[model samples]
Target: MNGPGPWGPAVDAQGAQDVLVHQALMYGSRHEYLLTAVPYLRAGRRAGDAVVVLVEPPVAAALRGQLGRETAAEIEFLDAAQWSRGPMHALASCHDRARADWWPRGRLRLLAEPVWRGRTPLETREWKRHDALLNVVFAGTPTMIMCAYDTAVLPGHVLDAAARTHPELAGPDGPAAAARYTAPAEFCAECDAGPLPPPPAVAARRSFATGGLPGLRSFLFTEAARLGLPEDRTLPFVLAVNEVATGIIRDGGGRGSLRVWAEAGELICDVADPVRVLADRFLGYEPPGAKGHDAAMWAVRRLCHIVETRSGPQGTQVRMRVRIG
Candidate 1:
């Protein structure tokens, strides 16, 4: 079935629409943006219909802050804890039970049939393929189908048969299904470079530090090559690397300025307090936990430089601005 056209009841169901957002199977780090789900809840309440967000514990906490006690009365938050007990149990126990009841029985019957089948990988894949297309049509909005990192090998026939033929469906990554619900067009156009213009002195300081040291230059070149970042993108990467190294110097048991440089748009680093951050590559250093107050701010400043430097249609460097904040 064709997805609902742009102006359809599902998308226009302001104040009276019953919408179910299925966020199951979403990992925390990758899907942290789901934290924005609370804003959707707030939107639903304002619109006058009930909004249900089904998510795991970590997501629940992040969302609760958005809803808070004051705004939460109208919206419902369902925890996905023990959702793995089984699919049927998950569907029945999800916070949206009442809303699901309002859906037509035939629709419910069709939806429930596949709940069992989703347990198997093959079935889940087929279901997602089916749902990706159907959600757009039925709901008159975009739906994101979470695919594995290795989606390059997906058969052309599979995508051809499932996707809608629309120019608006294009995403930063190409043919984005998630763009349906969230307006990808706006996201693509809006460039909010956070903070202000960075001092030239800071830029010069970084340039000098990187130029004098081969290790720092090599680091930038290596990482730039690794991510295929363009020559221009090196500055941002350098900034990002320095920001990280600086965080280490400030937080770790170090007592010197963190030094950085860029070569061919790759970052190299030398910390005055080296012992803390110069751990064995990859396996040695622990993964950075949730970035804290100062760390987050530093990330924002660095990412803003990246975005400002490379802002344009069809920009090579994917905008990393949002995560910085």
Candidate 2:
């Protein structure tokens, strides 16, 4: 179902009016990237929209060089590397930027590359989830977002998922409706139904009670170090797990299970409890104030490489992973 269009009179696939025009840019080279992006940025500038660009540093540099100092100065730039902090946070930030300063009177135009080379499988998963969640997050806002995926660096599966997540494709030619796009709710459901494989047998497992929180943190640190997770990532990894485990204790019947494993040069942690606390699939993806009781889960999403939640008759489970070495 669609609501009234907020960004003028644009219509979507279901004939529903919407203000958001979420699209993907799959480019195989730097030239192709500029070909599709330059004009898009120029148009936004000409229209006096609040234009923001979040991409890899090199790409940002290239755009700046091409746009020249004045035009480049007009666009706001954010580092895509910090996407590990959470796409929802980035989205909120962009929204806040558009609403602040001189941009409030105009529409929001964003060009973001949330995915990049050297990302772990877990990071890939979470960002893809972010892509699907974007539709729901900005549904009625007067915003246009283009998610760029480097076809030369990203796998075919990644590109395919991009097609599924975005409602349209923006290329050098122009924006067109995406033929394979799945509705936000349906795509999120599909993601929820597919849980990650069980932690490897070699994974260290332990059951923790309220008293074991300290031990749980120690265990995670040891495993993270053993897996050679960089010094910088170690703390966030532990803190993220700590938050989830703390949630399980305070809200999930006062106890939970913890497991840590290393595979594919990444560290994986799983936290589970008998209580089913998250009934809403979009818990972590929603804005902070809107998250209500699921705020801890939202924090976990921001800190970890990937945060996957599943609830069933058995119980609720949260799996978080981060790339080690």
Candidate 3:
């Protein structure tokens, strides 16, 4: 019963060594959700694993109510909003928790409920990429993530994607293999398949050489401010721009082009270098470890509201966005 399956992994057909057990669960109501969560947590407790539930307040209360005082108190109730700040940070937080808080003691049983109600299409796509990355992020760790979706509120596309993102599907009866599950790398690549639109004709654009880098930051700050970035956002926005600009100087050759604009009430900036090629898709996905593009990008993702990076035959380009209001 305790092996590579339902709440575990089947990485390969030969029963590949187990690592992360990633599954999706769809429920239309509180009762439906608890039908799987309650028993899942209880089983984790019985097996001596570290159990954690990340859900909304009302839903958490429902789960708590079902378990009574003692059982509810044993599991950690995490705020989904806080735990899912952004892709890089969320992955780092999950990795850190598994390593620091639970890995050695026992397996981790996480009932994850990410808030997706108000997310823009762009934001939702990025989160889906994060979900795909989860399979590999905890590659060798003993972790079971029950990613939850509310069938009533979420659109069909959102619920449909869960099937592709998770390796298995969790239901009241048990777990079943997710036939539509896409491999992490392929799934992430699919997310980036569409080319980002070019900056509008009215966009403020500039070309910078290695030495003109100082002026690049100045140009960026000035444009961002004039375009509607608040006083508080200008500095971080500049920092994010400089990180990409300098990174190009250090690694992507000595020159690149810059474009700035405002659209749909958000400030957008693009930095491009024809000579740079990215070899690692996860360069900045993890916590900043050492000095390199990885570290530079980690800062870029943190500073900007939403960042999209593309590198290939078209060259490498990084687009950073921050809401104007």
TM-score of every model? 0.29, 0.76, 0.87
User: Which candidate has the top score in TM-score?
Assistant: 3
Instruction: Please say which candidate is ahead in lDDT: 1 or 2.
Output: 2
lDDT (C-alpha) at residue 260 in model 2: 88
Error of 2 at 313 (Å): 1.9
C-alpha lDDT values of all predictions: 0.34, 0.77, 0.81
Candidate number achieving the greatest lDDT relative to the actual structure: 3
Candidate 2: segments with Cα more than 4 A from true spot: 1-18, 26-36, 61-68, 79-106, 150-154, 210-235, 290-293
In terms of lDDT, the poorest run of 10 residues in model 3 is 1-10
lDDT of 3 at 82: 84
- Model 2, TM vs. native: 0.76
Whichever of 1 and 3 has more lDDT, that candidate is: 3
lDDT for each residue of candidate 1 in 8-69, tens digit (9 for 90 to 100): 22332453333322221222242434333333345445544434444565555666666677
Lowest summed lDDT over 10 consecutive residues: which window, candidate 1? 105-114
| Positional deviation of residue 108's Cα in model 1 after best superposition, in angstroms | 14
Off by over 4 Å in 3: 1-18, 97-105, 288-293
Error of 1 at 289 (Å): 50
Q: Give the higher-lDDT candidate: 2 or 3.
A: 3
